[model samples]
Target chain A: MFNPPTELLPTATNQSGTRTAAVPSVGGRTGIARILLSRDTVMIYALVAFVIYAALFIPRFASPVSTGFLLLDVIPALLIALPMTLVIITGEIDLSVASIAGLTSALMGVLWGAGLDIGPVLIISLIAGVLAGAFNGLLVAVLGLPSLAVTIGTLALFRGLALVVIGDNAVANFPPALTSFFTSKIGGTGIPTVMIGVILVAIIFGVVLHLTPFGRGLFALGYSKEAAIFVGIKVVRAKFWLYVASGSVSALAGIYWTLRYSSARSDNASGLELTVIAAVLLGGVSIFGGKGAIPGAIAGVLLIGTINFTLRLGRISDVVLIIVTGTLLIASVVAPSIFEGVTKWLHARRHRRTLPQASASGATRATASGVQERK
Target chain B: MTLDTSPPATSETTTRRANGFAAVLRLREIPVTLALIALVTLTYMANPLFLSQQGVKDLLLNATIVIILSVGQAMVIVTRNVDLSIGSILGIVAFSTGTLFVTFPGIPIVLVFLAGMALGALLGSINGCLVTVAKVPSLVITLGTLYIYRGLNNAWAGGTQYFAGDRPDSFGALSVDTIAGFPVITLIAIVVVIIVAIFMASTRPGRDLYAIGSDPEAAKLFGIPVTRRVLLAFLSNGVLAGLAGVLYASRFNSVGATTGTGLEFDIIAAAVVGGVAIFGGSGTVIGAAIGALLLTTITSALTAIRVDKFWQQAIVGLLILAAIVIDRIARIRTAKKLRLSEARDV
Candidate 1:
């Protein structure tokens, strides 16, 4: 029999785990780098590239007025996406955001129509949003229904409630002060107060998601629910907070929407959840959860907004834009899978060349025996 | 293999709990069925004309399209997927069939039916490819397609509608004809349900669907062709939705891009109310059929009572909530049983 060295033992067992880790990192990071120049640095570069492209290609695309319009238009999506990003990172999703936004708008409309003061209307709207969120949290966190399914039902439920509340009526003419505060730019410089609100929310959530204990716990929950529970994270409470946050933010978006449009129709923002989700996915957040960032989501919104604006400026038909959005959603999902497949294929080839020759070695022979037994 | 190999005490307790819990949850549907029957009875009592054979036929006819759509929706939902684009698919197929009839006025209605189903299957395959090959979540993919399909239909059928006068009398007869005091359309829907029920319950592919839905990764590890099966599920769902579209065209005798707007959610609601878990795995085709009947009956009941159309949406919402509640209760019980068994194993 051939003598084998003891030092080679670690390479035979624990080395496989390290090998697996290294393979993914190389493929994910290095491969991403070669394609886009750098994995972590690409988002910033892309954003910059977009701004430059817009400025060069589209007239007035870099103007303050255009910037303001983009910011104002995308603010509601950003506000809602901040909390949605968190919930998704925690391995759950909130399909009811669009519905919640609709319901809140309807409630605001009803309350305003009923002659409630601004303070009371706002409070009621927020309360309504919170209660709806709590209902979702209870269903998923307490009763343990899958979030996707629960939210799908509630998507209908909440939107239906909105319809019942407003009943096809459009509510316009909010108090002048409210509109001024929410919709007006800073001294005609094109930066709206609502945009300011979005920025603040983004900065705060960015810090919380990347720096805080709760944020890490949320990620841990996403990575492995059982492990998170074992590690003493209040997984249920985290989920509850996530839902509440999602709801509150969605309600805020609704209020801003009312301010901007000065109208609250039940169908207002109907199917908006699709765009919100597409943005999140495009931002590089895994649909399976446990991996993503607010910055990425913001980047996604910018990318999508830029794409839409560019297409419009180019006078592309709305039909083509819709197709492009669909294509983007498809691309985001497929890219990672293709990347993974290629890496796996390469890694398998490498292993076959390097390890198969030593297949009859003691431990290798044992694994082969195990495979045979399993068969 | 049948006996859970958990700790004996916990396993026994878990088995007992699982049995009892399933029994209670299963019986919950009885109330909805009873309520449906009672409503029908009350309507009959309130207006004897409601019990007339003609009225029964009318009710069944109105419900047939939705019932067919719900069956397809249930199959898709069973795999933890949703097809919101079905409404658009239905619109596209219905209008296309109408246009085909208008263009080829010489063709038999049967050929038109096949053509509509084939087109639907083609659209569904698109959805399946986007989902399986692209690895995108079905919700986003279907949502995008919902708009695309609707937009295409609108563009193609813009400023136009196909009416009863545009189609042959025999084509219209599919919806209007009666057999044994029942509309042929409803009978066709019933036949569709029976075929779907068998496919879901008895076949190997059908059972594999439950496995995939229950745990996709686990199923894949166990050597299930996860992507292929999911793709097929979506394709089958698409085809059925398309078939519903064809029937819809024949039933309504008027087709346009707006033909099936918003029907997707309604069909999904029926599936959920039928006790099919939206997350996939456990559910019954029969339950979906009952759900369809319940929803359709409610609409007729509302119409019979002369309630406003607005109340219809609200009532549908209430039913969806009720179904979700039932689903939650069942899930909790199942989790509890699993936990108990796990405890025993420990």
Candidate 2:
């Protein structure tokens, strides 16, 4: 119903039936118009509107300590989402990230409980996380299996291994040395140390995704793997490393979760894969791949976190919170098509209106003069 | 992103080769069956009690819910979609069914089953409408509904649990009453499996599902009512999950908010292991049922042999990886053959 505007994408496909059209670039003629019409622009407006409304309406919504907790609460999802954005950008996904996070938490608890020194224990868990990610890379990249199915399998497998290590037992009372730094606020600014970590990761991921050759390869792959290959991109290697990156970052998030909470359990961050995904999509990352930004995703994550914090503060039932999340997830995805449809309909209405005028003015004059004044 | 090796040709075109159908059959479920047998044999040899009557009952009982859920899941997967909300649906229906039993205290057990299924169908239809009409991927839509439905369950049944003690003996006995040697619940699961398998293999719409899953654009071009077929697959899956919910109340004797939480993973694992490709097309519901059986038995065997129960999950993870790898190899070979044939024609 909403075919992309053909004029902007002529020769978008070649003889091999590959999609050669890139995401609409925000440069050159009518660049300002393109920016105004894009999803990211819409998201920025929504994020600002939401923050202002929440601050005014909700008691203490804009307070410093609350902001710190909000940032801390969203760190794992925020961190994992960076790599997830890349994974999705390449038109693939890593469903095993949350499970890997949970596994890391379980491992951290078990290794520490086994009386291993905390330093070595932490290192081992992180390595296990990397290996787990590499295994996914092997299947999806090297072996060419569907990431969804393979990750679903690993999702269960990793979660189960978590239970194997911890069973129903939970480990609390972690050492101050391990938990203190990540949890402590930075220079009395009410910003948790983890916020700094997230900001650093976001900066690195943002640069890699938007500026580097590897980044273009990712966008190209999302456009079409065959086209990317034809263009001489190392399609397989790029995808593999992204998956591994997703895994390691997810594990790092797991470590943060355990230390911040000062408790580790097999089910740490259970069902959180959905939350991370929702945040990514809400951030305006196209679920179909390609067409998204880390900054937009960051805003999306903050919006959801702010909503949750507000709901909790208002003492709204958890049920309401869940419904709001689902509604937002559905709306975020469904809204874009509806937005495109409306624009198309409006364009058609104007086209018909202008057609009559063109007939009156003579076609050549209408085409050149009338349109020339539009911009 | 699934870059399927085999060309998305019509089934007839693909299966016309002398060894094609045979290759498919060999690849689909034989490996899972062999693995089940081998694990059983090895586990039984180590602990004879594994094959003992009590052990057998535990294994069958543990597997029945997942088997039922997997059959439903395979249908959705064949449509290149998934229903993550089924677990939450089961939890909701199971709790409601438990409430029904307690409130009425004299309702027919059959009626309760119907009520539970209808409730599940209603929830499932929401997923269908969203995926079909919204055109959002089922994974995203269902993931959303998974939490929404679970949230509803929590809100409705907060801290309230229904125990078998509250139900009549006749109701709970339904799970245990045996026909020949099989548990009544297990018999029901087998019947459902057989019926679904037959329908999928024999019906026109069933074949249409395969066509749609194989290639959506091709199926649409063939005039297959793609949207309707996909909706039907989702609706049926919901009904089956609902049925699983009723059985959960019957067997487990306790229904609560957590009754079927996180169960979608196990169901999906079974379906995948049984050889259902997640990208849609290929594989059977019966294979999924067997996959459920194998996974449950693996869990049983690991526990029986005194291995860490944790390792059981890891092995299943390994099995899932192996199954996909094997399927991928077969696909590559088939794709190569097809390519060669296409070259000959050119």
Top-lDDT structure, candidate number: 2
What does the interface RMSD come to for each candidate?
10.3, 4.3
| lDDT, model 1 | 0.77
List ranges where model 1 is wrong by over 4 Å. Answer: A1-20, A26-48, A187-189, A351-375, B1-32, B38-58, B134-136, B154-165, B215-227, B257-259, B303-311, B331-346
Q: RMSD, each candidate, Å?
A: 6.8, 5.7
| Model 2 agreement with the true structure over A191-259: per-residue lDDT tens digits | 897787789999999999999988978987887788789999998899889988988998998999999
lDDT of 2 by residue, B1-346 (tens): 2234235445655565767767666668888998999999999999999998778888988899899999999999998888899999999999999999889989999999999999989998899988887667888888889878888898898889999898778878877777776888999999999999998987778878888898876676567777888899999999999999999998986899778988887788889899898888999998999999998889889989999776878788889888888778777887998899999999
> Tens digit of lDDT per residue, candidate 1, span B190-257?
99889988988767678778877887665666566767788888888888878888888788868985
lDDT of 1 by residue, A260-315 (tens): 88888787777778778888877777665677778778887777777787777677
lDDT score, candidate 2, position B77 = 94
Instruction: Give candidate 2 misplaced runs (Cα > 4 Å).
Output: A1-29, A114-118, A165-169, A348-375, B1-27, B339-346
Per-candidate local distance difference test: 0.77, 0.82
Least well predicted 10-residue stretch by lDDT in candidate 1 chain A: A1-10
Q: Residue B180 of candidate 2: its Cα lDDT? A: 74
